[model samples]
Target: MAHKFPRISFFQRWSILFKCIFHYGMIFWYG
Candidate 1:
C-alpha cells in the first residue's frame, strides 16, 4: 500500500514514536 500524502506519513511516524515512548514510560514506572 502507498500513502497519498506525505503529511499523513509524517503523522503516522510521529504517532508510532509517541506510542513507543508511552510504552517505555509505562514499563519504567511499573517494572
Candidate 2:
C-alpha cells in the first residue's frame, strides 16, 4: 500500500504527525 503513494505523501503524513504531537505538547504545557 505504501508503494501506491509518492514520497511527498509520506512526508505529508510525517508533518501531520509532528503537528499533532506539537499540538498535544502545547495543550499539556498550557492546559
Model 1 earns a TM-score of: 0.80
Could you tell me which residue pairs clash in candidate 1? none
lDDT of 2 by residue, 1-31 (tens): 7688779798999999999999999999999
Query: Which of the numbered candidates is closest to the native, going by highest TM-score?
Result: 1
In model 2, the runs with Cα more than 4 Å from the true position are 1-5
* Candidate 1 lDDT tens digits, 1-31: 3567889889999999999999999999999
Cα displacement (Å) at residue 4, model 1: 4.0
In candidate 1, clashing pairs total: 0
lDDT of each: 0.92, 0.94
Where model 1 places Cα greater than 4 Å from the true spot, the runs are 1-3
